[model samples]
Target: MLTWAGLLTVLAVLTGCTGSTPLFGDNRSPGDAIRIFPEDGAENVGADSRIEVTVPDGRLERVKVTRMEDAEHGQVPGRIAEDGRSWAPDKGARRLGLAGKYSVEVVAVDGGGRRSARNTSFTTLVPADRFIGYFKPENRSTVGTGMIVSFDFNRPVRNRAAVEKAIRITTDPAVEVAGHWFGDERLDFRPARYWEPGTEVTVDVGLRDVEGAPGVYGSQRKKFTFRVGRSQTSLVDARAHTMQVRRDGELVSTVPITAGAAKTTTYNGKMVVSELHEVTRMDGRTVGFGGEYDIKDVPHAVRLTKSGTFLHGNYWESPDTFGSDNTSHGCIGLRDVKGGSSDTPAGWFFERTLVGDVVEVVNSADKTVAPDNGLGGWNLGWSRWKAGSALR
Candidate 1:
C-alpha cells in the first residue's frame, strides 16, 4: 500500500537511528588459558607450602592439586580469586612422596563465560619424611626485644653438621650467631646475647630432604629478614624470689614473686611462655590426682605447658598469700577473683607474658622442666643439647 518514495524514507529513517551494523558480530571474548606459577620446575619449597595457579585472558573458577600414586587429590578448598584465574592449596595439604611429581589442573571461564582448562605436573622440592621450621622474630626487623627465633622440627635430627650447614644466619656488624639444639625437635638460634636494638638480621634455611636423624629429613629452604626491637629479658630466680627485668643485660625493675612450696615445688629451669589466656579453666582430674570432691574449676588459668602447668589467678587463696607463700599444688598462683575477671597480680603478669618470654625457675625441689615441654628450649645446656644431634 506504501509508495516507493515513502518506503525509501522509512528505510532511511530506520537505518540512521540504528547506525551501521557490526561486521564482527557480538562483543564476545575468547576463553582464558589456565597456567601454573613457579613453572614446571620449582625447588626448595617449605614442607607446609601451598600451590598457586594462574589464568590469562580469563578467570579461574576451580583448581585441583593431586599427588601422584595417590587418589586423594584435591580441588580448590576456598574461594577462587577474581579475574577467572588463580588457586591456592589448602592450609593443611600433604603430599605423599617428597621428590615425586604432582599434577595440577585448573579450570577457568572468560568474560564471555567460555570455559577453559589446563593440566600440568610439577615436582615439589620438599620431600615427605622431612620436617622444616620457620621461626618467629624474623631476621632483620624490630621484635619484642625479648623475642627469639625458634624452630620446631617434627622429628629428631641426628645430622648436626648437615642440619647446621642447612641453616645460615647473619646479623648487622657480624655478631656471633649460634644454632643451639634444645631437644630432638627444637632448635633455638641466637647470638651470645640478646639481639642489639636497631640492628638487622638474616636467616637462611637450605634443607630439602636433608637427613637429620634415623628417619627424619628436612624440607625447607628459606631466607627471612627482620629488624631488632627493644631489649627486655626479665630474670626470675626462685632463690631470691625477685624478678629482675633487664634491658640489654642491665637491671630495669625487680618485682617480688612467690614460687612453689617445698612439697609442691615449682619446676627448676628456664621456661618460655607458650600461650596467654585472660581466663581459662584448670581441670584437676586432667592432671591426675583428684577425687570427686576436689576443685574442678581453677579459673583464670594461663597455661604454660601441655602437662598442665600454669601461672593463673587463684581466688580461693588469700590476697596476701602471693608474695609471702607458695600454696599451689605445682603452679604459681596469683590472687584474682573467683570468675577469673579480677585484675590481680597473676592476671597482670600473665597478661604481660608474651609467647616467647623466658621465665627462669631455680631452687625448686622438683625436677627441672624438660626441654621438650612447650617451648622450654632454655632448659638444656647448649653444648650437651648439640651433642644429641646425629649430624654432630
Candidate 2:
C-alpha cells in the first residue's frame, strides 16, 4: 500500500539519521575517515615528494604521521599548507631511511559533529647502491666566482664505485669535472682548473632512493646549469716579491708585492679568492702575530685566510720596499694610491677577480694549505681526493 517515491523518502530520512556510519559495512564504529591522495596503496614516491590528503564531506581538524610502531606518535616536524588542507615536511624530514613500510593518518569532523579518520600505508622502494651525483652551485645563478657543484649525502656512502658511477659531469665545450671528497658526507665537483670562460656546464643527479650506507638512502635526482665567466689567474710567489696577474693564461700585469717575513712566510700551494673587501681593519693579535708595538689598523686589507692573511695597502712600507723585502707579518703587501682606489695593483686585482679566482702561491717554505680550508679542496690530486671517501 506504499508508493515508490514515498518509500524512497522514508529511506533517505533513515540514512540521514544514521549519519557518520561506516561507508563499508564492517559494522565497526563510524570512526575517522582516512583518505590518501596518490591513494591508499601508492608506490614510488619521487625524491622531491609532497603528500596530499582529503576527507570526504568533512573538514580536517588535525593530522599526524607516525612510524609503524605508532609509539613515536606523528611528531617528526611536518608543515601544514597555507590552504589548511594539506601538510608536508622539509626534504630533510621526508628522506626515508631503509626500505620499509610507513603509515599516515588524518582526522576530520563533519557538519553533524561526527568524526571520521582515514589511514594509509605505503612501502618505499629499496634504494640502489649506485646513485648519480648532482652538480651545481648552491644559490647564485651565473657562475662568476668560485662556484663548484657539491652534494650533501643523507647517509654516509660505503661504496665509492656505487656513488662515483652515479656522478657524471660534462660541458658544452667538453670541459672536464673531477670529484673530490671533503669528508664522509660532502663531495665537491670541479674541473682540474678553473672552468673555461663562457662554457655551458650541466650536472645531472639521478640518485633517488639510493642507499648511501646502512639504514640510509638518497632521495633526489638533481639537474642545474651554470655559465662560466672570464678565465683569470693570479700567481703570487712569496720569494719573488711579485704577483703576476693573468687573463685566460696571458700575463696582464707584473706588480711588485711584499711577502710575509721569514718567520711568517706566505703559505705555499694553490689558493682561491674566498672573499674581497673595500677597506677592512687588520688586527695583529687577531692573527697571533702581534708584538707589543704592533699596529691594529693595517688598512685596506683583503683577507685570504681565516688565519688573518691579507693583500692590503701598506702605509708603513715605502714603494721601493714592495718588490725587494719580505717584511712585517704574513700578508701580501701591494703599493696603493690611498683611498682603496681600484686603480692600484691590489685594487685592480681585487676588482677584476671574483671569489673563486685561482691564486697560485709558489716558492714558499710553508706546507700547502689544507684543501678543506676554505674552498681550496679543488687543489687536491684526483686520486688522493677520491681516497678520502667512505665509499671509495
Candidate 3:
C-alpha cells in the first residue's frame, strides 16, 4: 500500500519524455522491403488500429515501437513471432493509444547475420467530435480512502457501452473496481468497500474518436492517476448530538455538534466531503428554503452534498447549544468563534479533513441521502451498485 505521499513519486517518475530524432536506423532508408500496417508517413488512423512489422523475404530480427504520449515517448514492448518474419505488441498492450504519434523501427537479417534496418512513423486520428467527461479529484492528487472516481459528461451518452469501454481504470494490488451510472450524463466508479489506505489508481481515458452518441464522438485522450491517503470517517449521531472521529479504524476523538432542527431534519446516510471553505455565504433561498435565513459569512464550512448540505461552524448560537440541541436548517454545525480560530473545534476539524473523507449521519428524521448525492454511493449495497453499471 502506498500512501498519499506516493502520488509525488509517480508524478515525478512518469512525467513526459521529450521527442528526439529517429534512432536505431536512418529515416531516409528505403522501407520498400519492410511492411508496416500504418504505412510510412500515414495519418488520421483510428483508435482501433493495428501495428505490425514484417519482411517479405528475410527474417525480422527485431521490432521496436515508440508512442508519443503527453509529450512523452514510451516504448511499446513486443515479441517477434517464432518464425521471426512478423512482430506485434504484447497481448494486452496491443491497443494503440488514440490521438498518438507512433514510430516503428525494424531490423531484418538473413542466414548470414547481415542486418537491414527500416524506420516508419505515423500519426493517429484526432477527433473532430464533442463528447467529453469532466472527472474529479484531479490528476496526480492524493485524496482520502472514501474518494470515488466520478464523471460528468458534457452530453448525453447514448452508446454507453462504447464510451464506457474506452475508459479503463486500474488500482494497485489489483482490487476489482466497478462503474455505476447515475444517469445518461453522470457515472461513478468505486470498489465494493472503501479503498485501503495507500492505494494508487490509474485512469486511461482512451475515448477519442469513440462514438458516444448517435453522431457525436468522444473527444479526449488522457491518462491520469491519484493516490488514496489515510482513512478517516466521522460518525455523526444526530440524537446524541456528538460526532465520533476515527482514523485507520481506531477511535480518535468525540466532539459535540448540532444537527438540523425538527422542522428541517438533516439527511441520514454516508456523505463524502467534496469541498472546503474558510468562509462562505449560506442563503436559504439558494437551497429552496424561501428566504428563511441568509448568513453572509459562515466560517469553517465543509460541503457535504450538492443540494447545499454543509457541516459548518456556528458562532451565532450559544456554546451550550451544541451537544444538547438540534437547531439548524438541515446542516450540521460545530461550535467556533466569529471569524474562526484554530483553537476552535470546528476549525481544528476542518484543518485535518480531506476532500474525500466520509461523514455519516445517523438517527436523523430525514430519509437517507440519495446515492447520487455528493458521493453518497457508499450507502448503496454492493449488489445494487453493480446493477447501475452500464456495462451490465
Using all chains and alpha carbons, the TM-scores for the candidates as numbered come to: 0.55, 0.54, 0.67
Summarize candidate 2's per-residue lDDT along 1-392 as a digit string, tens digits.
11111111000000000001111121121332435554445555554455556554546666665433211123445755555555666547755533334566555556666444444555445445533232224322455434566664534676555665576667889965667776666677766656767878776665566566664556556555667778777788777787887777778778787776776667776666644555433333334433212322233455455444556666555556667777746567776543455556656666776655677788877777667654666567767765665444
Q: How close is candidate 3 to the true structure, as a TM-score?
A: 0.67
What is the C-alpha lDDT profile of model 3 across 316-383, one tens digit per residue? 77666678888887888877765677777788789989988999999999899989977889999999
How accurate locally, in lDDT, is each candidate?
A: 0.53, 0.55, 0.74
- Model 2 lDDT-worst window of ten: 9-18
- In candidate 3, position 284 carries an lDDT of 48
By lDDT: ranked, best first: 3, 2, 1
All-Cα superposition RMSD per candidate: 24.1, 25.2, 20.8
lDDT tens digits, residues 66-95, model 1? 553122223335446655456675565544
Instruction: Quote the positional error of residue 341 for candidate 3 in Å.
Output: 1.1
Of the two candidates 2 and 3, the one with more favorable lDDT, higher being better, is 3
